[model samples]
Each structure stands twice: as C-alpha cells, then as structure tokens.
Target: MTGLFADDSEQIDRRTSRWIRDAVGERLQQCLRPESRLPTHLEQLMSELKKRDPEDDSH
Candidate 1:
C-alpha cells in the first residue's frame, strides 16, 4: 500500500539522516583541530540545517 511504503520511506530517510549527521560530526571532531572554534562551527552548521527547507531539494 502507498501508506505503508510512505511510512517505510520516511523511516529510512530519518535513519539515513542520523547516520550522515553522526558520521560527519565524528569526522569533524577528529579533523577540526583548534578545538576552540568547534562549537561555533557546529552551531552554525545546525542553524543552517534548521533553516533549510526539506522539500526544496535545491542544494
């Protein structure tokens, strides 16, 4: 059914997002030296992510 498919698709998308965010965050932590600016960078990234429209699809 369409409903079932949609539900699964949404779940997959959420999991994928979590995986990507976690992977990027882990790598950022490992590669970003000057620990002082890490928080600022992370805050900016999160703020931008929150501002972006999920349905826009225009990167």
Candidate 2:
C-alpha cells in the first residue's frame, strides 16, 4: 500500500508540473510576441537617458 501511494503521488506531481510548465510557456509566448512594444512613456524616458549619456556602455 505504501509503495502504491508513492507511485500515485509521483504521477500526480508529474502532471501538476507539466500543467504549470504549459501555462507558463503560453504566458511567455504572449509576452514575447513580435507585436509587443514598450509603453510610450518608457520609450521616451529611455531615449532621454541615451541622449544624456550616449557613451555609457557600462550597462
């Protein structure tokens, strides 16, 4: 009975892990789509920063 429970538990854990991985992969695909763009405010801020210190390649 103990060994049976262990096997069942492992199977449940594997299914749960696979489900999480699939969900995260779907979310990542949505976030990384080519149509994704930075917000306008952030883009402006980055442009200003680059103009302020164009030589700052330390980042």
Which candidate number would show the highest TM-score if scored against the true structure? 1
Each candidate: what lDDT? Answer: 0.64, 0.60
Q: Evaluated with lDDT, which candidate comes out highest?
A: 1
- For each candidate in turn, the TM-score is 0.45, 0.36
Give RMSD to native, each candidate.
10.2, 15.5
**Residues 18-48, candidate 1, lDDT per residue (tens digit)?**
5676688688778878544567777898668
Model 2: colliding residue pairs: none
Candidate 2 achieves a global lDDT of 0.60
Residue 13 of model 1, lDDT score = 62
Off-target runs (Cα >4 Å) in candidate 1 are 1-12, 39-42, 47-59
Residue-level lDDT tens digits of model 2 in 1-59: 35656655445454465466458647756887678766788568656654655444555
